[model samples]
Structures are given as structure tokens and as C-alpha cells.
Target: MLWGRIYFGVQAAAGAAWWIAVAVSPFVREVTLGGLDPVAVAAADIPLFVVGSALAASGVRPAVWVATGWTLVVAIALAVYATVTTEAGWGALVMATAAVASVLALCLVLTGRVPTAWLIAGPFSFRPALPRRIAAAHLVSTGAQIVVFWGFFLVVVPLVITSLENRWSVTLPFPSFVPVVGAVVLVLASGLGLWSGVTMSVVGNGTPLPAAMANRLVIAGPYRFIRNPMAVAGFLQGAAVGLLLSSWLVVAYGVLGAVLWNHAIRPHEEADLEKRFGDDFRRYRDTVRCWVPAISR
Candidate 1:
């Protein structure tokens, strides 16, 4: 996960910068929100950002809850600031965008739809399991999805992107009601993403992470049709992020991500599986396209 790492890293940087901008800089304090004090606002934001950053960096669930809650706070504060002053600031809208992403991410995580740890893009802990520990295992899996996938993509990415572009004060074009469509698409993508994870956990007696690789080769349900349904889900959700925010920059970010994953990550992952599963993986690879699904498999 190049995506996961950059996403969380950006969030951490943005949160810290925002706090500094509001608290340490007197010019920012006096100038923002038509001269209204941003001191209290910055004070409340940094803790959630810090905690969310730490948990998300480690791929844990509390990160999702904390990030979502903090973004909501940022949105409300921006709304209040807008009402008190006539000057339109980009910061509030940025926070609103973050709020949308956070909420969307939370919805997917709470569904228990996927064993999310399986989706983490980078290196992470993947413990082996015993039968009796299955109950606890499921809980841990759900938490990983919330923290890693949900928190990183939705909250962290947006925060980092906004900060890097220095676009908090710049006005951009956004269509009305786009977020509604984005949400629906995100939900659908998440459902597709989770299907395989659920199968791996149920049939393979394991999650999708390499260290906790599934005990069985899953050849049922969606796996029968496409080799990488999870990638499909991730692609959709990634585009939805740009759609929801109406940011071409972020949209480009998501698209480039897909290209890199296709050319770089997928090949390495498949080779590993081929070495692990041998002929079984080879037959499946030949029968099913990496991305395209069979018509009626």
C-alpha cells in the first residue's frame, strides 16, 4: 500500500499544520474567519488528529471513529465560522469534504463486510490463528479494516491532499448532490471488496493478509469470476473520493493509483500466490482474467 502510506502520512502532516496555523501564528489567529479567534477550534482538533493518525498508521479501528468524529467537528466549526463572518474561507469546505469522506468510510467499516486487514497495501502484522480464537480473530479483522482502509483512504487522504495543494483558501468548482452519488458508489464498491474477504475468513479459515493467508484456495462466489475483485472495489471507492470532493487532483490521484497497482503490486502479489498455491493458482490465473470477470462463472 503506497496509497495507504501516503494517505495516512498526509493526514498526520495536515492535522499538525492546521493546529500550528491556528495556535502558534498570531497573524493566522487574528486574520482567519473575518478576524474571529481560531484558537479554541485548533485546540480541539489536534488531539483527535494525533490519536487518529497513530491508530490509522498502525491499522486499528479507533482511528476510524476518532477521525470521523473530529472531521465532523471541523465541519461544524467551519459552518459556524461561515455564519459569523461574510468572508468565505476554503478551510470550512475542506473540512466538510473530510467529514463526508470520514462518514462514508465509517459506514463501510461498521458493516463488518470485509476482513479489512487483508486489504492493507503495505507491510503489517499477520498472525497465525487457532480454531478457538476465531471469534477474537474476526473482531480484530474488522478493527483493521476500520483503521487501515477506512481511516486512511477517507480521512487521511483528503486531509493530506488539501494541505499539500494549499487549496484551503482557493475556490473550486463542485457540483451539487455529487456526494450522494459518490456515497452510493462507495457502498457498492465496499460490498464487492468485502465479499472476498468474508469468503477467505469463512472458507479458508484465515484472513487475506499474507502472514495469515487463507488455508484454502477460494474458488467460489466472486472469486470464480474475477481474480481481483478487491481491486475493482478499491478502484471504484478511489474514484468516488474524487467525485465526492469534486477535485480533479484527487481524481487523478486515484486513477494513477490504479495504474500503479495494476502494473506493480498485482504482479508481485500473484507471483507470491503462485509460488504458494502452485498449480491451483496457475489454473485460476489462466481461467480468470486478472481484472475482467467471466460472464456466468
Candidate 2:
């Protein structure tokens, strides 16, 4: 449980760091791709990122408390930044909505007292314990994720940005000066998402499923709400990337990601689950919606 807590805390902090980067990319020199002057905006985001990074490194219960506080702070900062920087009237509203949703989701992870039953860490936790076949599958899935994102960002997005008119202008409905929204969203989502996945993996680690990797089927905490909450959240994170870069190609990549998960990954995972848990897996599947929680049991 201590390991789990530590892992979760670090993940949260890393995520917060990412969010801070996104919220204040204008201020952060490294984040500025080129041509956009975001000195004031990045300046505003620096402290938040620093604080979040510090808290994540601390790795104590106190750190958890700090993470919780920072999550709220990041949200507020993003909201304020959005209101100030947006030239489009509707853009402010959209940014505000996204900010609120992002914050709410972050809060859910930061503050919620997830049961210890779902927390675990160490080399033997999940990754090491994965069976050969299932491990291969996971590798393939992870590789696919990388290929899609990198291919789009490096090759496809640049072409679109060069060819299309007002390409850079096509950002999330946030303040122009605060282009860090997407980056922040990705950071936050990745941090929390990994924390959740690790926790689930720990809990289910030792149990042997018919499928080796399937043994790490977590049914508690975030998983209790949705069968593929992690995947869904990951999609949202991808969307944030598209929004941050204001690239149609990136956004399209995100959409393609959803399709890949739904059509390719989910079915394979479910088949494995059925093989492992049998009737229990079916019962759970029947109760839980794939991505949407509102329809879940």
C-alpha cells in the first residue's frame, strides 16, 4: 500500500507538472514551438509547474495533500488564463468548459480515497508478471499508440500547418496566450491514468487469468465506474494534445485512436477477459459501458 501511494503521488505530481506546462506554455521557452510570443503567459504558469513538480517528488502523504491543492490551482489558473487570452467570445466559453471538466476529472483522482486493495508497486507488480502472449499484445498496443501520436505530430501536423490557412489559429477554445491547455491536459491525464492503471495492475498482479496479461484485471476504483475508463481518459488526453497544438491532423489522430481502441484493442482485451474470468467477466461487461460512465453499473 505504501508503494501504491507513492506511485500514485508521483504520477499525480508528474501530471500536474504537465498541466502547468500546458497552462503556461507562453511563459515556458521550451514549450513555444515558434512564432508565438507567450512571455507573460508562460511566466504565469511557471510557479504552478514548479510547485507541482516539487510535490510529486516529495512522495509522502503530505505530498498527496499538496497534489490535491495543486490540482485545483492548475484548474483555476487555466480558467483565468483562458478568460484573459481568448479573442473569440465563444472560445472563452469553450475553454472555460474544458477547464472545468479537466479540473473536475483531476479532482476525482487527487482527492478520492481509493481503497488500498487496488494499490501496488515494484517490478513484480504488473509488467513483470505479464505472460508472454499477453505481454506481446500490450507491447503491440503501446507501440500502436506511439506510432499514431508521433506519426501525426512529426509528419502529418507539419504538413497541415504549412498547407492550411489559419492553421495555428485552430486551437482549443482557450486564451491565445495560454496555449498550454492541451499539454497540461495530457500531463494530468497521463499522470492520473498511469497511477490508476498501476494501482489496478498491482491488485490483480498475482492472480492468474487464462490470459497471462489479463490477470491484471482491475475492477475497483476507476475501473468500477467504467470498463475502459483508462482508455477513455487517454483519448481525452490525446484530444488535449490536438487542442494545444491547434492541429487538425492531431485531432484526427485522436479520433483515429478512439476507433483503434474500440475496434481493435477493446475486443481483444474483452476476449481475453472472457477466457480468464468466464461468467464473472460477462457479468461485469454487461454492467459496465465501454467508455462512458453514465451508462455504466
Candidate 3:
């Protein structure tokens, strides 16, 4: 695909540039690995340069697989080390940007085509389980997911982005009412999310994760009015968090999530639903709007 090729090209260029910088530039060495010896830093980045070049040159399956694994490892290592050890600075920004780019490149490589079937097997499987078991699974999964989401998105990401903004001397001032409004929206959105989770667990007999999605078609509660209340609430919550933090990057991240979900995820999900439920899903989809909440016929 065009996008996959583009990403591969960019990754190759970036990998080569990084290696060259580390070899020749003391500043790059200091910034990349917290003042690691230039020799070691250069050696560490050799794999990055090699894998990227091989993948770009060959465009073969083995090269692609190797590049994917290398990039994933690099991304995870940079993210973990930077978040844990580094203070807010150019180093942090550089590492964060590289990590994000690596992740994007991975996604592009893995999902070469539009409307990937990645979520098909995970969410579409449904076996009839007792209501109590369903509730337990829902509670456990939902709680764990909530912790992971809030810890990463609301706490860690906002902190990093806001620190960068401050370092760059970019200020966005809003009225006192902004935080108040954000707080209200956050609360309301969280409430809606919880209600939607409960409804899914009780009525649909499943949790929200695609791997453990509700077995029954969920049209009760918020799903009755909106096709995707959880998604709506998530967007709202993310935006509200950005508002509270006064971080434009965080707000953009939230918007990006919505865009990705709408374009990449929703199609496969609805397609799976249509395939599984056939006319029932088609009728529900025809009656209920995707974004707007209204009385369903």
C-alpha cells in the first residue's frame, strides 16, 4: 500500500539519520541515551539503521518482520526509559516523538490495508455464560481497562505534553470557568461510560473489550439512543481532561482517537456485527444514528 511504503521510507530515512547523528554529533548522543558513551550509543542504534535499510531496500516479508520487531522494541524501550528516568526537556520530547512515530510505523506495517480484520476474532466470539460470570468478567476487565486508560492518558500523557508546552513557553490561558466546565464534562462523561458498561454487562452479557464483547445485541440503556455511547463518552472525557490540563496536545490526542476509531475500527466492528446478527443488526443500524443520540424506532 501507498501508506505502508511511505512509512517504510520515512522509517528508513529516520533510522539512518539517527545513526549518523549519534556517530558525529555529541548533542544527539547526550540527548538520546542520557549521556551514554558515544561508542555504545552508536552501536546500540546499528540495528535500527540496518533493519530500516534492509526493509526499505528489499520490501520482503522477512525484512518487514525484522523491522517491525526492531521498531517495537526501540519504541517500548525509549518510552519506558524516558518516562521513568528523564526530566522534561528536549530529550523527553525527542524520545516521545520517536516512540510515537515507531508505533505509527508499526501500525502501518501491520495493517497494510484499510479496514483490517484485526478485531474480528477477538470481539466477535461469544459463548453463552451465566449472568454472574458475565458480570464478574465485565467488572474485572472494565476496572483494569479504566486504570490503564486513566493512568496513561489522563495522568502520564498530559504531564509529559504539558511539561513540553511549558518548556517551549507556549501558554494557553482560559477563563476560570474552563476548568469548571471541564470537570463537569468529565464527571458526566464518566457517569455515562459507567452506565454504558453496566448496561452491556447486564443486558448484553459481556464486557466492552473486543475480545470479550457482549454476546447479545445491546440496545438497552445508552445503546438504545446512541450507537456508541462508550466511544462518545471516551472522546468527551479525553477532551475534558485536556481542558483541565490546558494542554492542546492532549486535546489533539483525544480528537485523533475519535478519528482513528471512526475510520479504522468502526467499520470492521459493524461489519462483524452485520455478519453475525444479519438482519437484526441491519435494522438497528438503519434505525439508530452512529453519532447522534435519539429515540430508536
Candidate 4:
């Protein structure tokens, strides 16, 4: 729900800024979408997005459906216009990123995998399930999650970032063996990620998703050495992929993900764990560092 609200708020704010730029700003007004003036289109976005934001804040489900459809159509239209106009730069990159984000958001909403309420709410907690039932279902659920996570993060996002880098002719030179080294790192990181996922499934009785969080405070496998092995593996894998692709932007993206995850998601996760497990989690947290492995044992 917090994320949902942020999405809607950004849309509303962006719509207003876009309108202001296209309407009265002389430099922006000179810009064209496929040789056509975007004045009317810009004018339409602000009110629509503002209303949608209001509706979302009120927890109206229908508003999300409508706003998502509207956003998707606009994104597609702009992307088509950019392609037709031979626009290849930051504008094109922004459009592509927005289009992908809109599509992913729509998919999440449609699948009902996320919480329904869009309004501000208390911290979410997943319903408890029998450990046996969760363990039994872990293989299927965790497998599906792995596929989705890999497809979206490793494939889709990298493709988009690489497109931006290619358009800007950005390249960072590296040794010939860099890719080989990256491959080795990728394999190691993947192994750690998989080991962590399996441990979460079997020992902790849950998936990696916060919505289906573990029942037990697992201290097995990679968890015993590092507090957030999965996160470490994910960051390493992203950086390795950037090295393999030879895209500096993708490497920076990996760094950005680590910062955001640490600041935005980590605190919430730790607070929730402490609330549930009390001193046990605090002790585990104090003993095990987040990014580094314990070596003096």
C-alpha cells in the first residue's frame, strides 16, 4: 500500500509538471511528438491523474484499473511516437522505462498478489499457515518466484538499461578476462541465492516474498554467516551481469538497488522480525552482519 500510494502520487506530480512544461514553457512547447503538438495530450494528463490519485488515496479499486489502463495507453502512444520520430536519447529511455513500469504495475494489480488497499495502512502481516503445509507448497511457489524474479530483474530490466546505454554510446573499457570473471561471480552468487531460497523454504517454512514470510527465524546455511545472504547474492549477481554486458549504467543500477533496498526495505523487514521474534531476532541481528560473513567462528 505504501508503494502503491507513492506510484499514484508520482503520476499526479509528473502529470502536472508535464503539463506545465508543454503548455507555457517555450522550449518545451517547441518539442513535438511525431511532428505533432503534444499540447492537448499534456493538458489531458493532469486532471486525469489527479483524479486517479485521489481515488487511489480513498482506496477505490476501480480507480486503479482505470488509471493503469490510461497510463499504459499513454505510454504505448508516446513510445510509438518516439520511434516514428526517430527520437533516440533520454526521452526515449524515459518513455521505455515508464512503459515497462506501468506494465509491471498492471500485472501485479491484476494478479492480486499485492495488497488490495491503496490507502495508507499499518504494516502488513501474512496469515500464519501450518509449517507442514507451507513446506509442502514451497517447491512450486518458490520455483515460480525464482523464474519471475530472474526474468524481470536479470533479463527485462537489464535489457532496458542496456538500451539506454547503447543509445547514449556509453561504454566502460575493461580487461578481456573481465567477462570470464563476471561469469564466475554470477555462478557463485546464483548458488548462494538458490541455497538461501531453499533454506527459507525447507527450514524457515516460507518463500522469500514478504507477503509469504518465513514462520521460523532461520539460522541455517548462508543465514548463519550473513544476515541477508539473498540480498547480497542479488546485488552481486546484478553487478556481475553488468560486467558481462559491459554496461556501466547497469552496474550503477545494481549499486542503486543496494542503496534503495538498504534504506527503504531493510528497516521495515528488521522491525517486523524483531516484533515477531523479540530478543531472538535482535540477538541474531547483533551477531550476524548484513553484507559480511562471520569468519572468526
Best by lDDT: 4
Which residue segments of model 4 deviate by more than 4 Å?
Answer: 1-130, 133-136
Report lDDT per candidate: 0.65, 0.51, 0.69, 0.70
Candidate 1 C-alpha lDDT tens digits along 165-277: 34344435778887788788888887887776777667666666655666567787678888887677777778887777766556666787788678656766777678768
Distance from true position, residue 184, model 4, in Å?
A: 0.8
Model 1 clash pairs?
A: 1-121, 1-122
lDDT of the structure predicted as candidate 3: 0.69
Candidate 1, superposed: residue stretches over 4 Å from native:
1-139, 166-174
Candidate 3 lDDT over 129-151, as tens digits, reads 34554476777766787777767
Q: In candidate 3, residue 136 scores what lDDT?
A: 68
> Which 10 consecutive residues of model 1 have the lowest summed lDDT?
112-121
Error of 3 at 240 (Å): 2.3
lDDT of 2 by residue, 41-64 (tens): 446444443454345445444544
TM-score of 2: 0.41
Where does candidate 3 clash, by residue pair?
A: 123-210
Q: What is candidate 4's lDDT per residue for 1-297, written digit by digit as tens? A: 545655666766665676666567655544433345565765665545556655654557677777666666766665555555544233444555655555445445446344323311242444333466647598667778888988799879988878756654345687888888888999999999999999988988887876777889989999999999989899988988988887777888888889767865787678878998999999999999998899653
lDDT of 1 at 123: 56
> Which residue pairs does candidate 4 place in steric collision?
none
The regions of model 3 sitting more than 4 angstroms off are: 14-47, 50-77, 80-178, 198-221, 245-265, 292-297
